[model samples]
Target: MDTASSSSNSTMAEFDYLFKLLLIGDSGVGKSTLLLSFTSNTFEDLSPTIGLDYEKNCWGVVSDIIFLFLYHEAGQERFRTLTSSYYRGAQGIIMVYDVTRRETFTNLSDIWAKEIDLYSTNQDCIKMLVGNKVDKESERVVSKKEGIDFAREYGCLYLECSAKTRVNVEQCFEELVLKILDTPSLLAEGSAGVKKNIFKEIPPQSDASTSGCCSW
Candidate 1:
């Protein structure tokens, strides 16, 4: 993976972000895999996501940018409760889909609209659409144009990513962080909402060496 772009300076202000990001999609949309790549530098293709799972990431930034990571997963029924609980103070939310699974992608709104409403009502939460599993072009069921249009309709940024190849995954996160930075108040609000994680104290070099975790 390419090294993340963080400023040379060291301070909490440089690393702070005002957005809470949540990943929502169908069971097999590679949400967990993507989270693993960003947070722990691990990528494990897992079995179907059952109830719900979560992880967090912290990114270094330059200029006025701050990046924080939030990853969450849930089943069809668990969607309502899980999301309502997690996205309460999110800075941004990423709704993901598998490019090769139209059914999975199609039902995303049905399963997650409530959660979207929860965060959207707060005004601080920005959103983005992510199409996952882009490496499987031959099996692709959704067109890039279609995804972009949907995102635009919802007023969100859109990007297709392949976690397996590490393609555009980092870029997608970067875009979200930069978008949140564009609004400083959101960042200030997120800072108060976000609690520090124990894993963050771990060194970056140590995390890189621990890639590809998760038995799945």
Candidate 2:
């Protein structure tokens, strides 16, 4: 289980598949912090995103299967045009909200989810509802049950994690990626209708490592 830092000298060609994932929510919801924690295994106070941010990481889910993670943080209003463009090819969408802010949690359904349905081309894209900042238990305004209820109604997975403490940060991505891998339609190829069953014959290995990198 080797998890590489963002500075690791890894190349895209080394991976078997590439998956585009987007991180979205209201500004100041810790989307950037969550991303920083995931890619570098570190956390830092971050300002509200002015426009867009991108990061890449590789996860070794199976012995031979490598997943290239492309993450885009879309939180600014001015970048709506540019951000909407990213929604087209997304394979996984991580809808994040700050646990201390009820409004951010409400926007997940009232705002973000609607934008996703409007722009996402992939109907089968996996969605995960993330309630961030669980470490601030005292400051929490949103309950875990509220998050679970939203996830159920929104038809997505739900997880509450603290990017600051690194709790469930890696597990959050791992679960989403595993779900994507299990979805056959997501693995389908070109317009010619050719499909690849990459994992069908490969037995699950317990010793696979996780490696990835990130950039601002």
Q: Which prediction has the highest TM-score against the true structure?
A: 2
Q: Considering summed lDDT, which 10 consecutive residues are worst modelled in model 2?
A: 199-208
Q: lDDT (CA) for every model shown?
A: 0.66, 0.72
Candidate No. with top lDDT: 2
Q: How close is candidate 1 to the true structure, as a TM-score?
A: 0.76
lDDT per residue (tens digit) for residues 1-216 in model 1: 233353345344444443557788777788878877766665787766554455544454653334454656554565434444455556778988999999877776665655587545357567889999888999998999989888877788889998888888888888887787777767666663454552443333221122212110
lDDT by residue for model 2 (1-216), tens: 345333445444455566777888988888878878987889999877655556657655545344444455446676454555567666789999999999898888788999998888898999999999999999999999998998999899889999999999988888887787778776552111342332221223212123345322
Cα miss at 80, model 2 (Å)? Answer: 2.4
RMSD of each: 6.7, 8.5
Residue ranges of candidate 2 with Cα displaced over 4 Å = 1-11, 189-216
Clash pairs (backbone) in predicted model 2? 6-213
TM-score, each model? 0.76, 0.82
